[model samples]
Target: MPKLIKDGRVVDDQWQGEILQPEQIPESPAAPVAVQLEPGQGPATIPCALSNLGLVTIFFPAFTDGRCFSYARELRESGYTGEIRATGHFIRDQLFYLQRCGFNAFQFAEEVDLDACLASLSDFSESYQAAVDQPEPLFLRR
Candidate 1:
């Protein structure tokens, strides 16, 4: 089993279902399908049974790839209530920002320290602007 940062703690990835491509979703799946999306892809692109999805795993092909950030935010804004997992080459430094964009689960490489990455999630006390997790900006909150 692989471990991942989920809801601020390191936990085993409980997903036992196959992660399929958007077009590969079966017309009637036995379990809620988990989909893997490219950086620029959206959940709407899934061929069918969009509402039956349990998780959406977004891949960060490289540390410099920032396009996934927008896709995560877009998923939240579009009312996706399933898990938005961040997987691949993103650094621990980006965890805080990724959470702000609505990624609730993170799967780093095998060598990465889960403890250190969990700590980085709280690197900042607050944010100046509104985000998915924090709807009110600091200015408005005050």
Candidate 2:
């Protein structure tokens, strides 16, 4: 079974249906399916087409590939309200930033110390700008 990190805790994924195998995510029967973007794939008709589907998962392939990061942010800006998940070579350190960019969940490669990683979610004491989820960011609180 795959492990999903939620609320800073590692737990078994309970989604019904065939478990998503390694490098395998089924077509989004819910409408928009998850899309995997490779390096130099170039953004074009695919993203637009998938956006209309519903739920889409933008793969990173590797943490070093920054293209997917941009793709994800663009998708949200384009008005994609569906779920956008980050998979492959993703670490807890990138969670908050990813979330801010519209990634709601993460499929980590291995079982991590949930409690420890969760601590990193709010490493900074505060923030100066509003994020997608946090309207006032952190520092602007009264």
User: Using lDDT as the measure, which candidate wins?
Assistant: 1
Tens digit per residue, CA lDDT, model 2, 14-65: 4444323223433334443445544465234352444444444556668787
Query: How many clashes show up in model 2?
Result: 3
Reference-based TM-score of each model? 0.91, 0.64
Candidate 1's C-alpha lDDT? Answer: 0.86
Q: Model 2, 12: alpha-carbon shift in Å?
A: 4.3
Report lDDT (Cα) of residue 22, candidate 2: 20
- Residues 1-142, model 1: lDDT tens digits: 8899998999999999889888888777777889998766765677656568899999888968888888888888877878989988889999999999999999985479898778889889989999999988999988
Which runs of model 1 end up more than 4 angstroms from their true locations?
Answer: 26-30
lDDT of 2: 0.60
Error of 2 at 36 (Å): 2.5
